[model samples]
Target: MSVETMTLQEMKFYTGTNPRPEDYEAYWELALVEVASSKTTMEIVPSNLQFSGVQCSELIFSGTDGARIHAKYLRPVTKGKVPVVFLFHGYSGNSGDWCEKLAWIQQGFAVVAMDCRGQAGMSEDKGGVKGTTYSGHIVRGLLDCPNKLLFRQIFLDTAMLVKTVAELTEIDSYRMSVCGGSQGGALALVCAALSPAIKRAVVQYPFLSDYKRIWDLDCRGSAYEELNYFFRSFDPRHEKEEEFFSRLGYIDIQFLMPRVQADILWGIGLRDEACPASSQFAAYNRLCAHKKMVIYPDFGHEVLPGFMDEGMLFLSGVKDS
Candidate 1:
């Protein structure tokens, strides 16, 4: 049966058809080592949206290649070090305004939301890659060496953000969670996989998984739209499809998830078109850590009702698994 028509029961056991690069593990290990060598410097700018009980600041730090990455840092006016939740935004979005983060702070959790580079945020993108002309991030640097992929750099930024947050005087490095929806959800899982410090990941309908499956299923719209554009404009005949997908496998979340040691609170909207539930299952099923799945059978790519509330309660004890 075609994946599009598969029942939810069938999706539970469906691993995608994406070709994982043989050296996926080694690629990330080497990439992690490369980022570890890069020096990270940070500056805290006073935030204009501060409130009486919460400390809000704009944080800028160096990501891979000295890109100036930006993040919003907020913490409750608490007496001791508090658990923290690292936040990532959706594709083409920024680290949202400070007012929205107050709820986490009010819950006694420190929050750090990073603005992804070259999207709708303050982070910098230092370009030095081949084939950089793509409609969206998925295929940016498609012709470059595996290390030059944009998501590779973004994934590295997630690790760097974790390292930076771990150093804050008011944060309990031993207790940290990561949270997001869509692209944010993917990066949360990416951060959890790459950074050993993360304790729990609250992933909501994650994107960037099982590209081959997405294509075959014709889910070439929304975030996956770029994949369709890349083929029609570049390869045109699926002649080099294997090569492209293998390269993409390096940054694919399913390949990286095995390294994740965090407790996972993964949510899926069964009707999700942008990121098909089968594509998400490709990554989720590989996780060996403590995990819980919250499914919204009637919803699409939109927010999962009550999922965030459930995740917040789950991240309270951010001790790394």
Candidate 2:
């Protein structure tokens, strides 16, 4: 079922064209320390979206730079502590409807679905770095200081979510996992890497890895259209090509993969154009922890039916990766 531009053999070996910045580790370590030390005011306002056997609440807290981050927290009506799974949505999308998340209650799971900053969600994007934003977040903090990069802050937000959820008395932090597809997939990896609290990750057709490979493969039009827009609008001559990619390297998931302690349950559509299989492999090949890939040869970046159920099983200990 493999229909990739690059043969499955080649894709497995592909390590990516995005260079890892020398200070990448130090930068993230410092950033994590900074966020951990910051006092974030937390509040869980009970949501009116009620359902049987499920209690829904909006978990809002201050992220780095005081951005108001929000997540829909769903806890099943159970006796003792339940396993938790942090859910991240696709780019420009919100934390999905409450009804969809309630399905996790079948496994007695506690779920947290985050709305990324400044997109189509209730989260706030406080970076406000006046720069060349191609109406997309990848380029939002590009022209400003490297530390202001949007994904950097988004990654921080994920770790913060894990930190926030672990404090709840109704959760077993040890059985936690992170799950998503496309942009959500990339974020799942980022969260697992930053917070080893996550034991499993189900990533499908993840975006935001191997940026240079995507550029060279010409797979930059869909989710990555901003890269083209940035080059045409600012670096028309490709003059700062290396400079920009190097900066992006800071947030590239391949660089962060080695730090991921979670056992991976990665799903890839070999025919995916929005997030090419080769680019995804570049990060997949670098993972240090145990991983199992679920390749969908005939599928694209669109929905892979039943993947949701599969992810839930993996997260709930019903299925082993």
Candidate 3:
């Protein structure tokens, strides 16, 4: 962890450069309405991937725009309305293998690992945006109306999944939670904000926070490299910089933090250049619910030691039993 990027004191008060749009609350409220209006139906099929004590299945559901979304659902065979956890993946990544998620199942948790739309997964993305879908999802609907932003639909998809999971007779809606790293972490926060049923969230080095801060820090590589690409390819002169960033405010997770009702357990790596410590803090500080942050001073974007164990403890409301 380099003190050169940001001091501990500075990170505590960093309000971030990405200004929240004035209509931020109304925008999300309307977006939620749109998601609610879309009739979502879910289908679950037994999967070949088997675990000793878990039942694995392919969970498919319709998202906003009627795009078919996919997730891997794993539950303990001996279950009676057990707690469930929604697992999101990293940027450009899929839901991951069932074997990797057996730990949670062993802890008596039902896990629904989702593959984000159009990512490296079975999910379908109905692309109808008017702009360049060349590099990343951030700029997918930049040139069109704010409603067309890919994340708007993605965020809605997360909310829709939560709603579907909450309504499941096999799940204890009051005990539902979400967990993920990087882009998945961002979606975890988004899901918690959009779904009041989510009881807890375990987010690690979440992406999609304070876009202008990422630009100012010149730390726009890896998952956020699309920001630089969008600038160079679309607005070379930086003339539409304000408009672009402001439009990006629609999907910025920092602005969505206030809407989160779930208890949050945030993990951050001080040495993370990908998501940046300041950007992570920007969203963490806005959280008004019961929250705790675990800081790994020497870590980067990779996994933090004992994070899964710690996360399970947090979500289970237990102390390493």
| Clash totals in order | 0, 0, 0
Which 10 residues in a row give candidate 2 its minimum summed lDDT? 127-136
Query: By summed lDDT, which 10 consecutive residues of candidate 3 come out lowest?
Result: 126-135
Give per-model TM-scores: 0.94, 0.95, 0.95
**Residue 249 displacement (Å), model 3:** 0.6
lDDT winner, 2 or 3? 3
Runs with alpha carbons beyond 4 Å of true place in candidate 2: 1-4, 127-135
Candidate 3 clashes between residue pairs 3 or more apart in a chain or in different chains? none
Q: Which segments of candidate 1 are over 4 A away from where they belong?
A: 1-3, 128-135, 317-321
What's the true lDDT of residue 134 in model 1? 31
- Which pairs, if any, clash in model 2? none
lDDT (C-alpha) at residue 247 in model 3: 94
Name the lDDT of candidate 3.
Answer: 0.88
Per residue, candidate 2 scores C-alpha lDDT tens digits across 1-321 of 332468889888888888788888899999889768867577999998889888999999878678888899999887899999889998888888998887777778898999898777788778553222234788868898889888889999998888878888899988888999888999999999999889999989999998888888786676799999999999999999999999999988888999999999888888888888998999999999999888888888988878767877887788988
Clashes of 1: 0
